[model samples]
Structures are given as structure tokens and as C-alpha cells.
Target chain A: MPAVIADGLVKSFGDTEALRGVSFEIERASVLCVLGPNGAGKTTAVRILTTLLRPDAGRAVVDGIDVVADPRGARARIGLTGQYAAVDERLTGFENLQLVGRLFHMRTAQARSRARELLERFSLTDAGDRAVKGYSGGMRRRLDIAMSLIADPSVLFLDEPTTGLDPRSRLQMWDVIDGLVADGTTLLLTTQYLDEAERLADDIVVIDNGSVIARGTATQLKSASGGDRVEVTVSDRDDVDRVPVVLAGSLQAGVEPVLDHAARQATLPMSSTDHVVPRVVRSLDEAGIDVVDVVVRRPTLDDVFLQLTGHRAENDTDADDDDSTSAAVPEGAAR
Target chain B: MTATATPTRSGPVPSDRHVVPTGATWLARDTWTEATRHLTATRRNPELLVFATIQPIMFVVLFVYVFGGAIQIPGFASYEQFVVPGIFAQTIVFGSAFTGIGIAEDMSKGFIDRLRSLPMYPSAVLLGRTFSDLLRNIFTFFIMLIVGLFVGFRLEGGLVDAALATLLLLAFAYAFSWIQALIGLSVKSVETANSAGFMWMFPLTFISSAFVDPSTMPGWLQPVAEHNPFTIVTNATRALYNGYDPGMDVVWSLVWAAGITVVFAALSFRKFTSNSK
Candidate 1:
């Protein structure tokens, strides 16, 4: 059975319709990344799937059990790491994990043993005895993940777990997540970070304005956005208008170039970036078009996002740049 | 159905056998776990325990020492003796607000989300909070008694009545806790939780028979104070503690306790179920 399935999930928070008939699934032991911008119902979808939300007009089945019908059943087989670290600042890392263990009804000895095991796995053994207030952001996040993993859940729901971490910390968290996936746990993660979706997601579902707009593998999505292509910025700024006509004419009988006048660049949609470059260059020479620079670019998920949603993801990477630029950033910005 | 699709790699067959007890057993365990967690924090945060202790003592000193000389009870030997029940009523009433603050803190801090995602128990968080605060109230009652004894507060109703008074106060506090829990769950923010938690306290406690005999109040406010639950408990506790006519106060105290507990517990549970989800 599939680990998770959400169909036409709908939810509203007062006047805001947070999830508008959104749907997706995670196959057992594979990652399904719910990729979206902030406030795009990513968390809402995870919340519904994790049984923390009851969708207004949809269904969620986890491990073959309907979530709304049996939230306790769904919860038993799933682990969730919310946007916040959720670690008790006053409690030691070990104590935090131990508390979760006991909350899960593990015996005291079993809880302690599991706490130590998770502490070791998360590389927090030394810091385990220290209050979580003393932990670095990454350490706290690790503890949060460890707490989620205490029950060894079959399906894991991580709702933007690394959304506020520094790059190094983000990577460390990614490593921990990678380890869990490697151990054969299915993961349903939500993120606004395109790279995070690309890096770890086996399949991606792009959600926007409380709906799923696109779903596919990363490669499929990038190509669907418009595949690998050559971008030519003409040497003479005025020649930009003529370049597309010249190139579309010489390259193929049916090809068309999408031109950006402001940038003075014409982007040729090509089957392969490198394979078509030589032929395009020969045609450009024949047409006597002098180019300032011609480079083949592989479309990133951001490109897919722009194609699907018609806007850039106001994301972690750009926000991180602004944050490190000025120390006035009181806390890490959310992705 | 997005989830009904094929599995790429099915997880191992029941890799971790869940032998977890369900129903009441799981709930009791979960509640106990949360109670211990709160108790641990109470122990580690010496400042909080000290503050919890000092605030009530300060109230006792202020009311008995500063305000005592002017205030008189016709049938009482001393103001301090008459004020002990009032102090008990006020202490536990205010202490009940901590339930709301704690619930709100858990929500803002995301601990409620963590607990919700687990399968062990549904009412565990609420019950655990009430349980822990009850323990603290018990502690506060003991402290207030020790300090009351020093200030010449006597128990003329004898030991059995005193023990019964303590139990009534605890029950009253437990009932009030559910009211706070509802506020906390509704507010769901640490800042708002505090204001919302204590918002009803001033009007509820100040207008009651806790501090003074409701007969001394102006006619307009006297009825409200007399019928108020805070006044009911305080009156009952005073009767039970000072060897007075235990009468309707005892019946009304338990009735109010049972009524508030059942009503607010149901209301809070309903809100908590939907809100947490």
C-alpha cells in the first residue's frame, strides 16, 4: 500500500482557504516534496496528512488508514517535524526525547534507551545532557527530528524542518533527513526552497494559492517548464529584435525564439543545450549576428516554478543573502 | 486518490511492533508523562517555585498585616483566622490561570503540535496540565497553611474539617483549571494567554466572599459576589475551617465545582479537539 494519499484536500482558516482541493501522495520509502511559496498551503497539506488537520472536503489515507476517520491510527504510523523545532528549551536533549518516548507510552527503561540511541544517531550524545536552550539552532533541529523518530514511524512528515537554518545547518539537517530516508522511511516534506525539493524529493508537487499546480519528477518538471536552452545577448543592444528572427529562420523550419527586449537576450528553446549550440552558432554567423555572450543554461526548479506559478519563489536562498548582508535580522527569516 | 498509487519501495513489514497500550492505559501513561515533565521544569526553575511561593505569602502579609487591623469580622477571634480561607480561595483561583498560560505557551512553543502528532492519548495534554497545576495548588495550600499558622490563623473546625476544606479547595481549583484551559486553547499565544487567563480573575475573585464577607459589600454587587463560584468555595472553606454553619456553602461548593468542571471541561475539550487539529 502507498504510505500516504491525499485526495482533493480542502481546509480553511477563517477567511483564508488554506488548502483548496490540493492533493498528492507519497509512495512507501520515497520522498514527496510539497513545493510551494510561503502561505501556499504546503503546511496545510502536511497538517492534514499528519492528522493534525481535518480537511473540509477531502480525504487522507496513511498506511491504508483514513486520517479523519482514524487520526490515532494515522498518528501511530507517522512522525511529524513541524516548521518550528518544537524542542523544549528548558529540557535537556535527552530529556526532550525521553519525554516524547514516555508520551508515546514507551516504558521508562525503553524510553531512556531510545533516547540515548537517537541522541547518538543525531550526534548529540555529548550535548544530550545539556538543556536545549544551550543548543545551537542545528542541534535543536536535530533533537526535534530525533523526537519525531522516537516511534520509528513508517511515514515521516517534515513541514519545512530546515526553513530557518543557516546554510551549514541546513546541509547538516539535510544529511540527517537523508539518513532517515536511507533507512527506509517514507517522507512527505513541504518546502519553499526549490533546491531542497530538487535535492531530496523523489517526486515534487508544486502547490500555489492553496492548490496543486504541478506534480512530477524534478527532471520532468524542469523540462516541462521548457528544457535546456541557449541564451544569446546580442553585441549591439539594438540587434536584439532581429536575432530571434534570424535564429528561428536559420536553426529549423518550425522553431521560435522567445525574446526579452529589456535584457537584450533571445532564448532559443532547444532539445539539448550543448548539442544545438554549434549549429546555432554557425547559423548566427551566416546571419551576421554578433553576440555579446552565448551560454547554454539548464533550467532550475525556479524556472519550473516561474512557468507553473507565473512568479518567482520568494525563497530561503535570496532571504539568506539579505540576512547575512545586514545583522539587523533579529531571527532567521522563514522560507 | 494521490495516495492510492503504487509504492516505489514499501516499508518493511511492521518493523517496529507497536505494543503500546491504547484507551485509558495509554491516556494515563501519557498524562503522567506530561505531569512529570511539568514537575521537572518546576524543580529546575527555582525562580518560578520561589515566585509561586512568595507571591501568595506577600498577599497574606499585605492583607493580614496591612489591611487586617481595619477589617473586622463580628464572630471571629482575629482577622488572620478569618482570612485563611479567603487566602486559599484567592491563591488557587489565581493558580488556575497558570493552566491557561501553560497551554498557551505550549501552543506558541509548538509543544502542543508535537503532542498532537502523537497517538498515545487525546486528552492527555489537557488532563496532564490540570494534574500538574493541581499538584502545585496542593503545594501552595500547604505553604499558605504553614505561613497562616505563624500569623495566628487557627483551624477551629478541627482536623477532619480542615482536611475536607483542603480537598474542596483542590477540587475547586481543578474545576477552574478547565476554564483557563479553554482560554489558553482559544488564545494560543503566550502573550494573549496571560491576559486572557487572568482577565476573569480580578472580577471573579475580587467580587467574591474570598477577602471579606459579601454582606459588607454594597447591595448592587453583593448578589453577584454571593452567587459567584469563587464566593461559594471560599464560603464553604471558611465554614469548614472555622467551625461555622457548613450549610448550603458545602453543597453549593461541590455543586459549583462539579458544574464548572463538567461544563468547562466539555467546552475546553471540544475547542481543544478542533483547535489542536
Candidate 2:
């Protein structure tokens, strides 16, 4: 049986349908990354699977227990780390972990030992005695994850674990997550960063507007989005307008190349870039366009978003509010 | 799926060690653990405790020194003896507002979300908070009691009566904390919770018999003051503290405390458990 299953989960907040028939499964001891832009129902889906919110339709099963029918049993098997660092600022790091351990029904001695172990595991042993209010943002996040792992839950859910971390802290967080993956823990991670999904996820589930638009390995997703692309950067600004026309003639009769006028570049999707690169460059040169560079590359997840939804997957680093209830703005809607 | 799938190791899993205590023991342990979380936080932030006591201390000093001579009750010799118990009831009841503020703060910070996801009973969070607030109230009550005595207030009642009176006031405060919990869960932000919590309290505490005799109020407002739960509790505690017969006030005050507790606990628990909506 799968370690986690979210089958046709549907939830609505009044007039807003936050999730519309979302479904996925995670095999035991593997990671599944739910990737989406802001307000794409990633948090809503995670909440449902974690038994935080009851779905209006369908069901979720975690570690062989039905989440709705036996939420307590499911709760005993899973742990959650939310978007915000949910540690009590007044409590020390060790105290925070100890409190969580006790709440998880660990005996006092067991709780204390587990607290010490987790504090050291997170490299917070020296600062374990100090209040969390004095800790850095990175320290708080590590402690938050430590608190979740206190009971050693079979399944762990991290909701945008590095959403607000600095670049260095985010890398550190990635290393921490890497260690968890090494421990063979079943993880369901939600993230807006495509690279995070690529780096950490065993399988990536791409959600948009409350639906799974695509799902697979990173390479599978890139291939499914479209094969390779021939990108040309022209030297002159005026040459940008003519680069696409030449590429269209050489590639196909009516295929339109994606244009970036300001960057002086145009990208055209092609199934095979081997035979077409030189011909495309020759065509552009004949059209009197000064080609600065020509490169062949596979599509990024950003390109996959554009292919599937007609817009780039926007990572809202500026948005500080929890995204579970963010408005379900349509793809490509103005920010 | 990625290429880094680790070979499933053979070992004892963490879930195997989980032996959840059944029924009442589980509830008791969970509630105590949750309460300990808040109490430890309170101990760490002594400045918060000091500030919490400061307001009640000021109220005791202000009423006794600034407004004491101007106000008089018919039966009592000095206003300090009559008003001190009222302040006790008022200060503790006012302290119940922290219950709402704390709940709202936890909710805003997503700590409530963390608790909800845990395996413990849902009641533990609310019970733990109110329990910690009760302890904090007891601490504040002692400070006020000391300050009240310093300002010429005396406990003329026997030790048993004084302790019972103190228990009744704390019970009423604990009951009020449930109502505050409901308010805290209803508000969207901590700022809103703070204002919503204290807005109606000023009238609830002042329009009653906390400072002066209810009979001295305007004719129309007199019945409202006389019937306020704060008045009943104040009247009960004051009678016991001043060595007077409490008549049926003690029974009535207990009834109010029990009734508010049963009704508001039901409401607050429902609000807290179903708060995902």
C-alpha cells in the first residue's frame, strides 16, 4: 500500500473552491513534492492529507489509516511543519522539542532524551537553553522541523519548508531535508520553487488552479512539456522582430517562436535540435539578423508551466501570508 | 520519482514505540503537557508576569487612595474593606482577557495549526491555556491581595471562608476564560482579538458592584449592576472577606460560574475543533 494517498480531494472555502478534485499517492519511504504557484491549493491539499481540514469530497489515507474516519490514528502516524515557524518564541529550543514530545505521549524521560537528541541533530545543542526569540530565522525553522520529528512519525509533511529563508539558510534547509530522505522517511513536501521540487522530490506533482496539470520525474516532466528548444539571442534590438519570422520559415510554416523583445532573444520549441540548429542559424543570417548566440537546451519547469498553463509559474517571495487561503486567481492574472 | 530512493532498511519503526495512554489518563497527560508549555513560557517571560500584575496593583492603589473616601457602602466601616474583594474579582476577571489574547496570538502565529495536527485531544489546547491563565491569575491575585492589605484592607473572615472566596473568584475567572477563548477563535487578527476582548469588559466590570454600591447607580442602571455576574461574585467574595453573611450570593455565584463554564466551554470547544472552516 502507498504510504500516503489523496484521492479526488475537493474542498471549498465559501465561494472559493480552493481544491478541485486533487489526487496523488506517495510510496513508502519516498518523497512527493506538490509544486504550484501561490494560491494553487498546495497548502489546502497538504492540510487535508495531514487531517487538519476535512474535505468536502473524497478521502485521504495516511500510513494505512483513513484520515477522516480515524484522524487520531492518522495523526499519530504523521507529523507536520507549517509555512511559518510555529515554535513558541518564549520557549527554549530544547523546551520546545520536549513539549512536543510530551504532547506526542512520550514519557517525561523519553521526552527529555528525544529533545536533546533532536536539538543536537539540528545542530542547536549550544543554543538549546536559550529562548527561541533570540534565534535566527534559520534556527527557528530547523527547530520547527525538529519539533515535528519529535515522535518520529512515519510520514512527515513540510509545507513550504524554506518559503521565507535566506539563500544560504535555504541551502542549509535543503541539506537537512536531504538527511531526512536518507533516513527513509515518507515525506510529502509542498513548494513553489521548481528547483526545490527537482532537488528533493522523488516524484513531482504539478498543480495549477486546484488541479494536477502534470506529474512525473523531473526529466519526464521536462520531456512531456516539450522536447528541446532552439534559443537565439540577436546582437541588435531591431533584429528581434525578424528572428522569429526566419525561425518559423525554417522550422515549420506556422509555428510561432516565443519572443523576448527586451532581451533580444527568441525561443522555438523543437522535437530534435540536432539537424535544426544550423539550418535555423543559416535562415536567421540570411534574413540580415545579427545572431549573437544560438543554444539548444531542454525545457525547464518554468517552460513546462508556460506550456501547460500559458503563464510562468510565479514564485511569490514577496507574499508573507499563508497561501492556503489565498484567492484562486486564474493563471496569468495580474499580481 | 527521483534516482535517490534509499533501500528500505529493516529496523524497529518509531510508531511502534508509541503507547498512547487510554481515556482519562491520556486527557490528563495531554492537558498537563499543554499547560506546561504555556507555564514554561510564562516563567521565561517574567516581564510579562510583572506587567500583568502591575495593572491590578494600580487599580488597588487608585481606588483606595484616589477614590476611596468619596465612595461608601452602607454596611462597611471603611471603603478599603468593602472594595478590596471587588478588586480581586475584577482583576482576575480582567485577567481572563489574556486567555483570548493568547489564543488569538497562537492562532495568528500558526501554532494552533501545529497543535491541531498533533495526536492529542483537541480540548487540551483550550484547557491548557485556561489552566495556565488560572495559575497566572492566582499569582496576580496574591500580588493584589498583598497590595490591598498594605492599603488598609483586612480579611476579617476566617481562613476557610477566605480560601473559599478566593476559589470562587478564580473559578469565575476560569469560566470567563472560556468565553474569551470563543472570542479569540472568532477574531482574524491578534489586534482585533485584543480590542474585541477588552471592549465589552470595561462596561462588564465597571457597570457592576466592583468599586461602589450598585444601589448608588441611576435607577434604570441599578438592576443591571445588581444582576451582573461580576456583582454576584463580588458580593459573595466581599461578604466572606468582611465577615458578613453571604446569604444566597455564594450559591448564585457558583451557579453563574458553572453555567458560564458549561455553556461557553461547549461553544469554545466547538469553535476550536471546527475552526478550519
Best model per DockQ: 2
Clash pairs (backbone) in predicted model 1: A5-B3
lDDT, model 1: 0.80
Q: What is the DockQ of each candidate?
A: 0.32, 0.42
DockQ of prediction 2: 0.42
Residue lDDT tens for model 1, B1-277: 1111112232321223343356665677788888888888887778769867998888888899987999898888888878878988888888998899888888898888889988768788899989999999999888888888888888999999999999999999999999999999888478898898888789999898777888988999999998888888888899889988879888888988999999999998899887734
DockQ of predicted model 1? 0.32
Calculate candidate 1's fnat: 0.54
Off by over 4 Å in 1: A12-17, A228-271, A275-301, A309-335, B1-16
Q: How far does residue B168 in candidate 1 sit from its true spot (Å)?
A: 1.0
* Cα error, candidate 1, residue B58 (Å): 0.9
